[model samples]
Target: MTMVNLSFVLFLLCGVLINVQIARSDECITGSIRKLYEELNCIPEHDETNGCITSYNCSFTNDQRADKCYYQGREFSDGDRLEHNDFRSKCIPTCSCLVRDGRAEFNCAHYDCAEFFQPPLKKNCMRTYSHDSCCAVGVYCKKENEEETAATCEYGGKVYTEGATFFPNEEPCKKCICKPGFSGSLESPWCEEVFCEIEIHHAESIRDNCAPVYFGDNSCCPINFHCAHASSDETQETEVESTTITQKANDNTPTCKFGNSTVEIGRKVRGPEECTECSCKVPPLIECVVNSECQEGKLKTAN
Candidate 1:
């Protein structure tokens, strides 16, 4: 062969060998690291000739600088120990990471008596319902009840079990159905709350002042509102009785009179007195309805 041709052939052979080596090197990633990369969506650019990954392209952030894998700006790596920055309770402790069943796992230390009983420097110690020791700064302990007997009525700070029903107060709507327990304990006694139906004699006057008129049965009439006539009333030319009204609160927006307080749209007004809850809603039509805890098992209707 000629010298020029021989040189060209040798050069081609060297290039082919180099490409093969690159391809081999690119496939040399560790199995665990490959899986980690895949999970992070890190597609490494492979060098065909050396078979080595040139770039991981894993998302990195300040917090994950030491991690081999990163995703969504968070860094993670196997066999890492970390502590929760927010929670410092005895039940939760420092955690360690591990690879389990091809997925990342965190093993946290279990709660211990020493940690649970540790006293707070400036807080009182209280026993939890479970009898565990806890700081009492924000804890609400159950009130101690000396009289364990169940009773049908509670009057003058004394419990009585003589009747099947009792009136807790003079309010016509406030009463309790006596349901004596076998153990005769006052814990969660059964009581049926009644909400009386209220009617405003002069609803028009309330509408004139832009004030919501409340009705018993948890409904309220807003100012400047009108109710649609019934199908039967529509066909007749007789006078249509106004069934709806509209009123406004401070903002001139629609308001609902729930019990004694007036509630505006998107605002919460609680009462009749403390035990009741209510809110005013708009959209689909503006209306006020009773949303009280005493409303359970009762028909819910909007006024």
Candidate 2:
């Protein structure tokens, strides 16, 4: 061959080799994994000689495909070995992150000092200690008089000691008690607000201008009506006496108005309007007392 033709052929061969090298390099990039590590800013030094990337600060074992990587920062992946550093021992009892089904789960189970200690081969008691004979490494231990094993209750995102009494911070009227159980279980202790009813009756004479009022527990009766007994003698006189009743404005008690007259709580009013007897009692409740004999007599006379 001519020297010039040979030179051109050699140049074409070199270009083919360069393209092949570029394609091979692209295959090694593993774009998805590289992007993930880049986003986390955790990609480590490349070990070109061994064809591996070393995240020196983290210890991980690669699966067959190296698709999932587990590390000990704030999370773990499935198949991760539970190690001493995975635990947070800064508070009474120790807590650790457990990976299950590719999700991070938390648990608090460490109890004794010995459990916090590493094995002899890996023994390094840098942060492990005993406080009151409890695990005290990398975390605080229960105080001398502290009850470390008490089961706690959680409600509305707040934790409470078992048997604690409190009203929900968001609902002052909802008095609740905490008992040991699952945090969100239906059987968990809860707050209960008790309610009562109030009713007011108006007299026959005032019935046209006045009406009965009803109220629930911790509520105030209407202010318009006075309760008094009618004269039983031949005079048939009606007497009305006014009494002042006041309740806290912030009590959030519900009220109901029946007519023009405001019902007075904890009072009695005679009513010939409907031949009914009524009385207002504590808790702002009102009810009619049935006169069975009178009712029976009326029925008998009618028959």
Candidate 3:
């Protein structure tokens, strides 16, 4: 290849390496400006005094280096309006990603909305709830609209007929009654929680280690029962563990003095008295069993 072509290739390679070295995720506070380099194919803006700082200004394909904003796993430019909600996803709709102090940060407007245990009734106006914003009233009652009251309730994106009782799909356990207001009435749709009463069966509860637990239909609370036994494998494992512990205890057992001799555990000592075989089963206590040792070696031969 020609030396001029080789030099030009080397220069492009050096520029690419310099750009790659500055595509750092840590430059942004929330590590969002890295997407401009990694995903959006952007180059770091290098100044003669400050080198490369891509958190605020990154040159994109648009042929301009502009400040960027990031919010909710997305990148946006300045003056970009962000559509988001609060944690409940039903309130505090005003959220935006904007350049506040030389850096992009998310700015949200938090409102302390009054909460009602039951659905509230708005005066004169036909009330509508919004899942997008916390705005409860969608339409207002004007003086010309004297008889524009709706007899149906609008909730969760669906209009329900008046006096309709239904279970909410989001929460199957809660039952809501839709009582939309007329032109003169003032009641709105409301929901109530149904709790099951528990009854204890004293006689059957203590019958065994395990008892039946029951649950009510479409209810979060169980019918309120207790007790479950270990599985057969679990019981066997517990038994084996107990046996191993017992064996270990016996292996480390102390000795006991039987008359003239200091005997270890499980050692059968023919007692000084007749027909009694005394053995040290536990430390400091010698258990004596009167039995077939009295018949001499006949007991061993029979076994």
- Candidate lDDT scores, in order, read 0.36, 0.36, 0.39
Candidate 1 runs further than 4 Å off: 1-73, 86-91, 113-303
lDDT of 2 by residue, 75-156 (tens): 3334444444432222334334454454343444544556446554332112322222224234223346556554566777
- C-alpha RMSD values across all candidates: 31.1, 33.6, 30.5
Candidate 1, 1-303: lDDT as tens digits = 999999999999999988877667544532112322333344565544456653344332222322232223344477666564422232345655555555444455754545357665333223222111122223322235544333334554655443334444333233344444513333334433332111112222221212221333322122122232223222111221232212233453434333233444354432233333233432111232343444543534332
Error of 1 at 176 (Å): 28
- Span of ten consecutive residues with least summed lDDT in model 2: 194-203
Cα lDDT, model 2, residue 204: 24
* TM per candidate: 0.18, 0.19, 0.20
- Candidate order (TM-score): 3, 2, 1
Per-residue error (Å), model 1, residue 70: 9.2
Worst 10 residues of 3 by lDDT: 197-206
